[model samples]
Target: MTTVRPLSCPHCGGKEFSFPDKGRCRCLACRSEFLLDETPKPSPARPSGGAGPRRLAALCFLLLLLAGLLYALAPAPAPQPASQPARQRAATPAVTYELQQLALAADPTRDGAPLVLRVRGGLGQKGPAGYVADCYDPRTQAWSEETQRLQDAVGKNAREIRFQAMSDGSLFLVLDKSRLFSFDFAARQWVDARPLLERQPRLAGGVVQIEIGYANEGDALRVMTADGTRRYFYPAVDLAPTYDELRRMVADYRHPQAERRHGFTFARKGAGTSGPQQLIRYAFLDNKTGPRLFGGYLEWDGEGQARHVKRHAHIFRQAHLEATDFFTPDRVYYRASVAWADKEDLIISFRPTPHPDAPSLLQSLDPEDGAIRWTLQCNFDGELVKTADGFYLLQGAKLFRISEGRRPLAEPQRLF
Candidate 1:
């Protein structure tokens, strides 16, 4: 008998087998036939208990790494309060304003008296309704309001009203160029001048142009007919000339010479001889390079010759020589609009061309050499009023007192 050994199939690892021949055996589970080998196989070794310590150390390292990741992902803690007190925000600086608004419209007369008018409604639609007048004495800085309401007597049909102050301390109101009223501090009431105006034959039958001037002995209201015939009314004496004066008492005031030169039009002109030097100021406009304003002046000799002509021209965009003209679509022709010279200096006001919405500029220039004395930025265009001590700028519903000093402008003082 041969010695027998336990056998298993190598391909299928089946343990149960059947003997097919003397040297071959067939696996019962896999149905494979193979030669049986009596050789013994070695077994794999099992893990020992010492490996547990290594696994536990690896798990602790993993937990530590996870905690570190979580710590890194978390948000930073709130900042701790400082040992010293916290800093405070800085305070804002105070702003300085330049212009002030008034309740009434103020203008100056030839005799240096300011005429203040208060109109309640629109001048074009409601006329001079609810109107009051005041006479301001610059010498005393006192205001005397008129006693009567002008609208009560004039009525609302007088759509337009113009106030003119005479050299003799009287005020004239021309309503629609058809009706005339005169008042003085003594009269205290408006006197109807239509009767005096009707007395003149030349003004009786036709449409005439009425204007106030210092043509007669004192201030007179002159009425010119369509045919160039003129009549004068002296409110001081209530006198209207009987016959048209062949030779006028005063020659017409001469305007500055305006001539286009060097691609510029002298659109505005002003003449002032009150200063030590006589200057014919002009505002030049050049439409070619956008719109630029050039403030210029011509020094004239007694013989009507130009002694020196100087122009200060610079490039600007959409510069307006006359600020009011920006709103007028028809382009009205004007003789003087921008510049005038007082006893001390040549004053000019114009809209800054570089910035369309910027405030208009008011500048004083030296009468001798045309050097800039000082400059101011005003919101609205104003009329300059010359007085004994200083100048007053009459803007719409606002008054600015300008002193002779080199400083810009002083605080506004309410007149009434």
Candidate 2:
């Protein structure tokens, strides 16, 4: 509705006004009517105080209201929980093989290690006494002679018992009679491996050397005479081999006179490879330098024909075992034969302790250059069988299952 502006009527000059129609206005006092001017009056020139600032303030107020409404209506960002500090990762146990002289001053492996076994079996039980076998039960911290009862009667007469490891986590008890008995840890049973080891070549320390592992049908057994003058290889078999049957299986005729006259032992055949390749080890005792080892790898086909041959030696040069190692203050007092060897590595015994009762060091070396790879203070006296995970160290009558771990070298807890 438009407001009628009062005007002096033309007849009576009245100031009163009224809206008689949509656009006409009437003056009541003078009874006069006229068209109403509905146009808005132009705003007065900005007041002395300036209305421009007032308009701007109103616009700002509206923007603020709109922002507040949006903030309230929109979903709130996750609480974020006051930005909790990042959780630190759990620390891994620190473990290292002590290679430094300072770190090895005190033997940590034996100081308080729980006794797992005590050798009670001996060769005198019948003939020349063999080592007594026992096992350590970590759960009970007690020693038990579980291995002694599992052997065949012949195995009981061996001068000493040896651990022959297989890739499938099976263990072979190699008796002195060139016989083998299998024991499965998972099955907790003994296998009559006597058939597989029938007519085996004699093996002894400081005398004959024998090594056996996986072959196609069963195992590829090897025997080397003390002088390494004669080496015999027996392929996998399906049945117990007769004395004459085994003689024909020996591959001694395939080697050269030089290799036969001296000795060759495999370093690594990558025993993992079930192919036609295998490792041959070479042993030489030069009167001037003492003893040295070499690796000879042979690749052949099903026809028993040679495909490739590689030879490696001088792997222990860094050890200097032939030089001042066993004499000087470097603490290398004694050097022993390899306790473990493969194509790529050689694990040997180094007696560093002057005290006869102290433990010896087990050092792994690179087969290519005899460079020391790692050294662990172990009391096994170069007696052990390796598995994929680590190895079982045989100390006295007890067997300790040692795993490769990162825990710092510290006194073992009284968990035994």
Q: Taking the tens digit of each residue's C-alpha lDDT, what string does model 2 give over 61-149?
A: 99999999999999878767465444645554443211110000111233322233222333244433333344454546654646454
Task: Please give the distance, in angstroms, between residue 203's alpha carbon in candidate 2 and its true position after superposition.
Answer: 19
Q: What is the lDDT of residue 174 in candidate 1?
A: 71
Question: How many residue pairs clash in model 1?
Answer: 0
Q: Write the per-residue lDDT of candidate 1 for residues 304-334, one digit (tens) a residue.
A: 2333433333212213332211111122222
True-vs-predicted CA distance for residue 296, candidate 1, Å: 16
Candidate 2 vs. true structure, TM-score = 0.32
Off by over 4 Å in 1: 1-132, 136-146, 149-157, 165-171, 183-191, 204-339, 351-353, 357-359, 404-416
Instruction: Tell me the whole-model lDDT of each prediction, alpha carbons only.
Output: 0.48, 0.41
For model 2 the local lDDT of residue 339 reads 71
